[model samples]
Target chain A: MGSDRSARYPDGGDTGTDRAPRDGGGRADTGVGRRGFLRAGVLAAAGLAFGRPLLGESAADVVRMVGARGPDDEMTDAVREVLKAKFGDRRIQTGHVQLDIPTDAPDGRAVPTILDIDLPITPNSYVATYHLLVDHNPDIYLAAYHLTAGSGEGPIETRIKMRRTGYVRAIAEMNTGELWSAAVKVFVGLNGCG
Target chain B: MPSMHHDSSRDAPTLTFTMPAGAPSSVGEAKILLPLSVARDAVIDVRALLVHPMDTGFFRDAEGNPIPAYFVNAVTVTYGGEQVARFEWTSGISRDPFVRFPLRASREAQVQVVWKDNKGGVYQQAVDVKFA
Candidate 1:
């Protein structure tokens, strides 16, 4: 199962090529050539049928759906429900936050993971809260951390139990009414959610 | 079960900040392990270790005394001047938590982290981004 997913994503190498701009320019461009545009249009239309975001949506908009509403048993939906109750109508972007976990975990009893917030601390704006979530677990919501200006400066590291192969997400809320998030997919051989 | 008494002597929460040694000089006591690649996507992978006991206040000590709950309450991350990520932590987290995340970066930017404990102790650290 792990190998299957790995084949689909193919490490980070394939992601580079897939995201590379067709134009030979140093800047990162989201535009495409005429042929590529037509292909994207077709894909976008199909995406609509599958409830996926269209090409018109920004990357941030697409990324925000990482933990959007899903099945009641889904971890993403559980986290999304909590977030909606906490912060209504606030937009969460995909930057300045990282959720690190192995692509595959042979032992789901304890999977080493990390949630790092790389944004600098400022008097005017700073991180105020953190939400760590795991999908497919009996308890989708894993942990929550609240930080102030006096909290330590370092990433929060720990081991998490996974019931099955799923994604882990870390969401951070700032004092300035902004939220950031990051997620990673992991495949677990043993079920730990029991 | 141990006694449910609180010790007045060890009531204060210990606070410290550290970063990885070597390249990417750090400012102040806080340091971050950021391996930034200058790629077209420019996705920066960030890893940092936080020092905290994450005491749940549920277990009893050797003498059956209840340990006071002392955990990092919250953490926030910001890039440049824009708010990025924030975390609200609970006692379920383990001790000495390690956090890792990725941020989209194209140029040198300032990253900051602020964490607060249950006892109102706040610690803040800042680092500058460097590409390898």
Candidate 2:
């Protein structure tokens, strides 16, 4: 669809608005669980496979149910599953890090996003692989990127499709007993994602 | 019969970010019909796209709780160990922010992209471009 974002893309960047601030973003050291999980909401491939959206949970909380674990722990569960499947239930913290995002998105379909890490990722002392996840997307595993000593300390710019407004998390497992995470919940307008 | 006026502006918009086949994920020849060349000192437009949902944290969950808004705040593109461009994301930006721009020339250069959210976590990707 034609959008102001499209016009801004050619060169203008994005529109300017003193968006109202919501909950804290990049709250890295906030507790471990119950809150402060990067898009901690998980999704159940089962629910998606069966078309059971959110399993009667709140739209925001629905994203928390990523892999059929419980209604409130979707995103966390899915991320844990991703880590477990890839890293064998490695040590991950619900509060190791936080995901950075805009507070007021004009639309949802193509909302820009960035995943950040508060810890160091080096050749011998850092996170080797990371997963960028969206809990409520039609597909939970939006894209996973592996990192090495090469990637600098910053963010990998990427975008994902949101079936609806939900949580997004970037789970990073270090070589040691350290797991870092970051999350940000996003809201989208109706018909935001096609 | 009475005429029914449809609110043209009320219609929901559509979004698509599918790139054509054979499109290179990094610098060099890519699909999408844009003429770009990758080389040392070869200024060429690099087509970079990431598929994202870009949740604003403003939408409601199944229970209707508010989904907080979130998006990338900054983006940096570096060529051959040198920073070429930096982008700042805005709320007005679309979900998937794709741009075709000139990559400053560099031999065996890597197009390194780093983006950060409002929090401190960062994500990075490096695309190597070796000019023939």
Interface RMSD of each: 13.7, 12.2
Model 2 TM: 0.41
Model 2: interface root-mean-square deviation in Å? 12.2
- Candidate 1 docks at the CAPRI level of incorrect
lDDT values, one for every candidate: 0.58, 0.49
The number of clashing residue pairs in each candidate reads 55, 81
Mind giving the per-residue lDDT tens digits that candidate 1 earns over B5-119?
A: 2322233222222234763332223446777444433555666566665555644565667778787767778777655666666654555555665555645678888878899
Distance (Å) between predicted and true CA of A62, model 1? 8.3
- Where does model 1 exceed 4 Å of error? A1-76, B1-132
Task: Tell me each candidate's TM-score.
Answer: 0.42, 0.41
Using DockQ as the measure, the top candidate is: 1
lDDT of 2 by residue, B35-125 (tens): 3445555445556654333445545665656655655566666666766555555433345456444444446756777766555546666
How far residue B14's Cα lies from its native spot in candidate 1, in Å, is: 40
Error of 1 at A178 (Å): 1.5
**DockQ per model, Cα:** 0.11, 0.07
lDDT of 1: 0.58
